[model samples]
Target: MDVEKVFCMNGGLGENSYTQNSYLQKKGSDMVKHITLKSLEEAYVSTTPESLGIADLGCSSGQNTLSTIREMVEAIDKTTYKFSNITPPEYRVYLNDLPTNDFNAVFKILPDFYKELNTERHLWSQKLKSSIYIAGYPGTFYGRLFPDKCLHFIYSSYSLHWLSRIPPGLYDKEGHSINKGSFYISKSSSLQVSKAYLDQFQEDFSLFLQSRSKELQSGGRMVLILLGRRDRTHVDRGNSFLWELLSRSFATLVSKGEVEQEKVDEYDAHFYAPSKNELEHEVKKEGSFEMERFEMFEIEHYSGPYMSHGTAVARTIRAIQESMISQHFGEEILDNLFENYGNLIDEEMGIEEIKPTSFISVLKKL
Candidate 1:
């Protein structure tokens, strides 16, 4: 599959859009706001660049996209005044995501974003001397995306888990799928399936670090918040089980002849939730950045204000995975598939508590 073509969150501002369903991602960002701000401040103080370069990788469309950028700007603004006692540097912000991302939505909202920034500046009795220029950069982050030594602060949230492409070796020489009946690593998957995923992540993440190392200035800082696991185990009750529920939803569709079994067996999600050890190992081995801070937190699937936990989780997953699912399984099954998924989540929630885990890391470019 061409991941660049079909891999994108559900776009636009509709009920099922990522804009409406990204509260959980917002919450995780909030959890690490302090760390992100501190890291950015430190990077700015160290460099004192006349024109500050900041890039938000995997910055998808919506309020969350600009909201996070706004906060980072605010942090730099205050830090410049507090430490350097001078006007902030000229801001050059790059908002990046896949080419298929709904950049139109983001572009349309720029006026309001600028207005809000100006209003906040006035409310704080601050005289701005430097202008903030924002631009959209459409591309993948797994490779080079910027000029050498141009960025001082980089941020990516809830996006690193997505592999550059589906890992190879899921099928044999005869093209028979090995990870049948599951879209991700599961208890039933063979060891080869698990190793393939880990290898892909290692390659992608190392390339990510290498690319960013070239783009980042010395003493630059990058804050990464991604879905993660608590231990070395490839299969867990958190994200892995969520995929299990999704697989069961497909099974229900197949059983009713709504979708073909062959289609289901041949599909696999291009995502991996790595452990803390896995992240540390890669960072050390790559030798380009120093790990400043690392944290792990859990977001309960049932914490949303929706009428039911299942509805909330279902909406969130749909906003993220609908594009891929529709491209593969046909858009006709989305409603029934999510309905079945929500029901399964409700049943599972009644019996056991499930909370998805996330990680926040602060890396300083050496």
Candidate 2:
């Protein structure tokens, strides 16, 4: 599959859209907001650029996208006034994502976004001394996305875990998949399967650091938040269990003849949840940035007042995974698939807790 052309969250403002189902992601972003603001302040004070260039990589469409950017801008604005007693710099903001992402959804809300931003600025002072120019950049973050030494502060939340592509070598000498029964690494997967996933993450993350290193100006700061595992084991009680449940859902479909077993065997998820040690090793190996801060936080999955725990979790996963799954398995079975997924989740909730952990890292270009 062409990942750039096929990968994206479910779009629009419908019930299943990412816009509505991203509360968990929003919570994760809030958990790291202080780190992001602190990093932005340091980047601003160090470089003191007249025009602050900021980029949000993997910036999918929704309120979370602009809300996070607004917070960063506001933080810098306050920092500039406190230190220099002068107007903040003009803002050049780049919002980036895959080519197939719903740029239209983000663009549609810009008028309201700009209006709100202008109103907020007016409240601070009568004069609007600084301007923010926002533009959408469509591409993958695994390679170069900006001009050399241009960006000042970079931010990405809950997005780096997505691999640029499914890891190679999942198949054997005769081209049969080694991870046949699972879409992701699980307790049942062989050591070779775990190694392949980790190898892919190291390659992709190294390239990410290399590309951003070239684009960021000297003394620039980058704050990254991504899903991570707490232990050295390939399987975790959180994300891995979710995938296992989905795998069971697929098995149910296959048995009932609603989906094909061969297609299930051939498919693999283009994602990885790295351990903290793995992240530290890659940062040291890349040799371009200094790690200023590293933190890990966990968010529990719970039932909302209006929905069951299973339903809430199912919608969240569907909003993120439906696009890729639909492309591979056909869209017809999505409803039944997720129904089974939700039921399986409900069955498991009584047995164990579900809490996904995430990592927040602050890196400064040397």
Instruction: Give stretches of model 1 more than 4 Å off.
Output: 302-305
Q: Against the unseen true structure, what C-alpha lDDT does each candidate score?
A: 0.91, 0.90
Per-residue alpha-carbon lDDT of candidate 2 for residues 115-155, written as tens digits (9 for 90 to 100): 89978977986545788889999999999999999999999
Candidate 2 clashing pairs, residues 3+ apart or interchain: none
Residue 203 in candidate 2, Cα distance off native in Å: 0.9
Cα lDDT, model 2, residue 343: 89
Clashes of each: 0, 0
lDDT: worst 10-residue window of model 2: 78-87
Total clashes for model 2? 0
Q: Give residue 337's lDDT in candidate 1 (0 to 100).
A: 96
The local lDDT score (0 to 100) that residue 270 gets in candidate 2 is 88
